[model samples]
Target: MLDPILKRIASSPVLIYILRCCIGFLIGYKLYITYPDFELFWTLLSIILVISPEEKDTRRLSIERFKSNFIGSAVAMVMLLFLEPNVYTIIAGIFVTIIVCRLFNVLNMARVALVALLIIMVQPHQTGFVEAPIYRFGSVAVGCIIGLLIVVLTSIIFRPLKRKFGIPY
Candidate 1:
């Protein structure tokens, strides 16, 4: 039993995932310090949460996420600038984000965009509308970039380890 367990641990996808998650956490902590906004935490969390164990198109995913984040942030900022912060505006912003995501055919990033909209529209942030979206967008964009970089860099570093350990990464 011990031998099998050890083999599985040494040859499974666990090490790569562990490395990616640690990288995410480190980046998140750094961003939290750099950006005074509390929303920065969640932006990083979202990126980390999306880190896949299976190999995929990280560049395409990052592009989709950034585009979706921008759409949501821009729409919410426009609404906040021109209108009052109320249920109608929030709902309108949500609807608009969904529509825009569909139009762009970026359904993969719709949820991310909606989250950006919520970050901008939901709370009466002390930073106000413009600043709030900007911060949210900044943190999210950074997280996405860093997360993809981690995946790429870690993949390179882990390839040899995977080979030696017979890991199925």
Candidate 2:
């Protein structure tokens, strides 16, 4: 009985998403309450786990994520130096960033571009171009690392996942 229930829970994507969201929200809320400055980092990490591809696909996603972020942030910094940023400017930058990322043929590069655009436009003073890009990149790196660690730790401790799934160790 417990085995069938566990299998069903593992197999259901919707259930998994719901669970992840709940957990993410709780963790995000706690982080926000404890350290508001770091809330976004934790929240974004949670979201990353929800959107992350399978373990086998993580390598490609991680590579694309890193490359796109670095390039997009650089482009955003150059743009910021040239133009005065406003809502319209930020939106336009996002469009341009997306186009460029798509040209590069990197998966989810648009998301990285959006992140870069937001960092430049929304929090320029708090984190200048010189430092913001590094901070943004660091946030992503930390989040992905934590997410991967969680996956591995859960798999090891629970030991419920079947070997037949062909997931990389």
Candidate 3:
């Protein structure tokens, strides 16, 4: 009876969700403690949530994420050079970023870039334009790395029920 119960618990979907949540929380917590920045850690968590490889619909989602991030960042940077760092300006920047990214067919990258740029631009510090871009780039890089790590780890552990799945990495 005990062995059957144990087997049932081990094979439960709830157990998998609980484990994934724990791993994500732990990773997010460590990132927050090390960086002491809410933006960075939240970005990492969002990436993990959105880009999970355990899902059957991952291919398109992954491509979209990459594209949005790339395009969004580029649009955000270009807009930054022309606008002051204010609430209204930030809103306008975001609008412009999305529109431009959509128009240019690189909306995935643009969306990520826009968020990164907004974080840098809205901060109180007078970090120069050069430094702002660098930080934004760095944040995206960190988010992507964390997201990829989450994907690989989850895939290896869960072994999703896909008919055919292969990752070259």
Worst 10 residues of 3 by lDDT: 160-169
Q: Whole-model lDDT for model 3 versus the true structure?
A: 0.56
TM-score, every prediction: 0.70, 0.54, 0.56
Native-vs-model 1 lDDT?
0.71
Instruction: Report the C-alpha lDDT of model 3 over 1-169, residue by residue, as the tens digit.
Output: 6645544433554554466556666776677688763345545544554353335534445555655664555555555666666788778878877786678675645656566556556654334665565555455555655655555575565453221233222
- Best by the lDDT measure: 1
What global local distance difference test value does model 2 have? 0.54
Model 3 TM: 0.56
Q: Candidates 1 and 3: which is better by TM-score?
A: 1
lDDT of 2 by residue, 147-169 (tens): 44444444453344434333223
C-alpha lDDT (0 to 100) for residue 28 of candidate 3? 64
Candidate 1 C-alpha lDDT tens digits along 1-169: 6656555544656655776878788888887888664567755765674565554554456567767776777787778778888999999999999999999988778887888778777856766656665666566666666776777676676567657667654
Ranking, lDDT, top scorer first: 1, 3, 2
Please list the residue runs of candidate 1 whose C-alpha ends up more than 4 Å from where it truly belongs after superposition.
Answer: 1-11, 34-39, 53-63, 158-169
Q: How far is candidate 3 from the true structure (C-alpha RMSD, Å)?
A: 5.9
lDDT of each: 0.71, 0.54, 0.56
